[model samples]
Target: MLRTGEQYRDSIRDGRRVWINGERVQDITKHPMFKPMIDVRARIYDMAHDDATRDVMSYEENGERFSVGLKLPYTKDDWHAKRRATDTVLEDIGGVVTRVGDETAGEMWSLYDGQDILNEVDPRFSTNIRNHIHHVIKTDPFHVSANTDPKGDRSKRPQDQDPDMLLHVVKETDAGIIVRGAKYETAAAYANQAFTKPTIANWGNEAMSDYAVGFVCDFSSPNLRFIARTGFAGRAPARDYPLSNKFDEVETLVVYDNVLIPWENVLFYQHTKAATFIRATLHRYSAFAFVQRNLKLADMLIGAALWNVRQTGLEHQPAVQEKLATLACYREGINAHLTAAIADAEESPGGLLMPNQSLLMTGRVLACSQLHHMMHIARELCGGQICITPDVASFEDPEAGPWLDKFYTLNENWASEDRRKLLAYARDLLNSDYAGHRLTFQLFAQSPPFAHLAAVYRNFDWNEALRFTHKSAGLSDQVWGDKR
Candidate 1:
């Protein structure tokens, strides 16, 4: 059943221990650092019921309504609906938000795809993943992901180093497994639950280890401490840092101190094979939503750059147009990949339709790799005034206001207020501290550059290229023989 915004807000206020900026947060939903994002997330939940967006964001099935974003994708139409739903959220919120339920829900779907591997380990474990997937659809919880751990001591195994460095199953009981460690998760403080799993670890000779565990953790579970990073919101005026103040999804280093995972919530446990399988394909389905955020970000870059150029009549210049075109190319490159990925959707082993992995993974690389250059081009186009422009306070001052207005105003068509607002937006988007953090987030959020290329390698059809080259060079048929 669909949930209302208030229901979501009330769900996270379950007395979960949380700290941000070195102070204990009493109510995360009401905390200043978290309130803005929580409101956005709650708004997304409420959007399903809103008359204007109800049809677009939700669907009626069997006398019940379910979120379009959380629905299991089985066909091309499902993907398009999911995309439209995400686009609608970004438009409604006026900015990009990555960790909202839709982006992280697919991580569970990726786990669902690995049901066969889970069954190979233990059939019961496979059932756990399937149940969780359906539970998401039926309950429409605010799901999130927890993959990265504060892993320590690269040289030593989890045993040799502090075992708690990586989240591991410390002990077992009739109730469930007791886990202790930490995870770096975004939006965990306000979200309902997370698909908690291990980070990328090289599973050595051991078939079973404590670190090889994955579970769905409830935020209300005790012994879990959410230590969040300092947020970008409320640090300055929202008008000055528009996106940062409104859309910063506060990340938390969630510390699990013997947190109990009920038997039903455990998806996989004490099995390196299950952990390794999940590690390989964790983002198989989620990467589409993650990369889709880049598309919106690109639009923001283009809008900022184009507006700056148009304001000054610099858009007519040949060099300026070329720079704008470079931004456009980057935007369209992402758009083309997303468009074609859905057009050529492939079937997963688990009977779900997965995006064209090659295209999605490659598009992630292209969009992330070239983002800095695109930002720089946008920065160059916006010019130095973005940095040197006085704040709103200076423009509003009685004595200084006239002098500012006289120079800042281009004409009656463009007033000082409009120009200042645009420049402020451009500054925040291109040159602010928040801008740099966003760039870094995109780079490492899905993993480093090498891992992205690895996904591309794993999914790419290497044989096709090899086949074409082999025929072009007139290679002998025995080149690919079973034996040398």
Candidate 2:
């Protein structure tokens, strides 16, 4: 079920409810801002067919070949290998920042969805679970997992809010259930074929039964509409802003107006405990996907920073050399965590490989650290050029051309215009709203920093290390609590 970019585009072009300002988008593909993002995502599909990336984008299984996506590996080694493959694919594409399709979101979603149903299988439902996996692999449909409910107030329960504020089963028919409500900030929803679950909502004891449901449906199924995101970043001109042209991030409000799902697609309904259990477990595995995403972005930043060092003719300066070293350290730290987690994966009950939780958690904790430091290093090494550089268009102006050429000139090692182009790219990243938006999302999307640290403190076993230290200090290991 390999989809070309255009094929993916045409699938979602059926007049979804997309509005910016006051007008609804008639055609998402031709929309000025949305088109660039679609094109970038198309390139990701094209990479699968590319000679350079084909090896990384696909893998061999049982004498047959399959696309290596967010695939569920049969063993721990295969799991790490998949991560390596994801990194390689992302590198060839220059990074994972702007595009919608990077294999992380969909691959993991399918894996978790399959595992959830398998966990509670009676013979009949178990067979249904297996069939869904086969269907996904054969069709290779695009999927986005919707977990966040657009809560009216963070403190209130789903029942406390207006019932319509939450997405819940409104009616159960012999055929399937009908769902109404919305999920917001659904990344890749515009191009996805379906949405998967554990629904993230406060289903108080009373609301639990109706809310604790998981299922699948076609993206183009009746009564669904996408309210596309709008702003300077989303609406920037394509020709004038080449980087923004493809791979724009789209946030959509997925409105489910009485959508129906057949009996087979319903994984959990009326089992509130099962829903919570599935949510906790999936959150654990999603750490692997996050590592894949962060590593890809860090690699891109490293390339940009190194190029900036040379472009500014400061590559040899002591200060610049030190900044590059710090940048390299960030890259090495993230890769090291990912490597260690892979090296220690354990097989789970549901026939899937799970990352070592402590190592994976450590990886999550350090994730933002690496990114923050990369931004700091970029500022130190790149200089004001990232913020003050002239636009690519300035060269076209007769009055500005002579001054642009004269002042923008670099040393004999590189042409001034060439240097300017690279700096301009960095400038767009650092000086524009893109940088701030990234920071906001990074903090906003994550749990509180202290909550993460507390999990690390509680979940990791430090007894072995503590015993070793006490013995090294010439004290008996007995000073410590039971080795058990």
Candidate 3:
């Protein structure tokens, strides 16, 4: 059964211990800072009922097709449906706001939540996965997010940092284990419905092995505390601000003070060998998902920019047309890589369908870099009108209205007020103190561009690359002169 938008609202209406600026939020569903974000999430729920999205957003449960994400076909056709659904959701979100703790994030985690036990206990990890699938089919779990604690300095190993800085299994019991410490940048944790598997440990020290543990838990689990960050878009006044009026993008510092995890939610507990495998496998899937999400965002931005261009009568301008083309190219490039990844997807040993690691990583790398470059192009194309646009307040003044109308006339065809609205929306996106600088920040922060590039280069099979290069140059695969 799919959860309806109203059902989603009901789920978060009460029993949530969410705090924004030291005040307990009784109803995130109605809170000004959270309502728009929640509304966008509800729209995702509405997707399941959408005529165009039903095929991908909802799956009929046949006895044979046990899992949702994996029960689907491993084909480009399937990828298209998923992309459509993702695009539908992202398009509804005009701000940085997200229900990261919502259904999508939970569904991703449940994909691997009971993974290790599947081979021996449940045999498919399908029970909970299906429940989650149905849940998302309705409301999308309301909120979900992941955390990967690098711990201290990047140059140091996890063991080198204060052990508590990373979440780890401190004690194991017959029923469960206790975990302590914290993970930085657990985005959307404050509002997400579920917590994802923590980071896998990669260190030389034996004491740090507990840090490799993985588990799923509710957001309000005992001993959990949220340290909130300042507003990005959701903090602005309702009437005038462009993006903030419609969205709230929030992040938090999640502190775990001896949290307990039931054995049922524990996916991999200090099985370091398997932990490494799960980590790498999840990394591949995350990259694939990011490619799809970021591409949709880029494509959406392109449409918005081009729409403003046409509305402002700048479409005929040579320079404006050139900038739009570049934006379009970035969109197409991301699509190409995403398609290539889907085309090359493989089935993991655990029976989960996953994409090509190298392709997805390369796409993520390109996404961050391209997104930054694209936003720069948008800023340049829009000119100072984006930054210096008059406050929406001036429109209320009778005397100023005529002056604004005369001086800001793009053309006599469209009314000045209408044009002002579009400009305000554009400025909301391109010029706001939060929206402008933060778009680049999210893109860069998704994965460090430089580290991603290094990983791609390191993972590249140079011999295979050279072989392809030679083949492309019309030489045989053996052009390297090593027949062996």
Predicted structure with the largest TM-score when compared to the true one: 1
Candidate-wise lDDT, in order: 0.91, 0.63, 0.61
Q: Give per-model TM-scores.
A: 0.98, 0.85, 0.81
Candidate 3 on 47-110: residue-level lDDT in tens?
Answer: 6677776666656664221212323334566555556656556665554433343223423543
Cα error of candidate 3 at position 107, Å: 8.5
Error of 3 at 228 (Å): 2.3
- Candidate 1's displacement at residue 261, Å, is 0.7
Off by over 4 Å in 3: 50-56, 63-73, 91-140, 150-162, 184-192, 205-208, 307-314, 458-461, 468-484
Candidate 2 per-residue lDDT over residues 364-401, each given as its tens digit = 77876556667877876778777776666777688998
Cα displacement (angstroms), candidate 1, residue 134, comes to: 1.0
Candidate scoring better on lDDT of 1 and 2: 1
Error of 1 at 235 (Å): 0.7
How far does residue 433 in candidate 2 sit from its true spot (Å)? 1.6
Query: What is the C-alpha lDDT profile of model 1 across 1-484, one tens digit per residue?
Result: 9999999998988999999998999988888889999999999999999999999999989999999999989999999999999999999999999999898889888888888778877787889888988899999899999988998987777789898999999899998999999999989989899999988558878898888889999988889999999999999888877878988888899999999999889999988988888878888889999999999999999998888889899999999999999999999999999999999999998899999999999999998999999999999999999999998888989999999999999977889989999999988888887888889989989888988998999999888888899899999989979733
TM-score of candidate 3 on Cα atoms, chains taken together: 0.81
Clashes by residue pair, model 2: 36-245
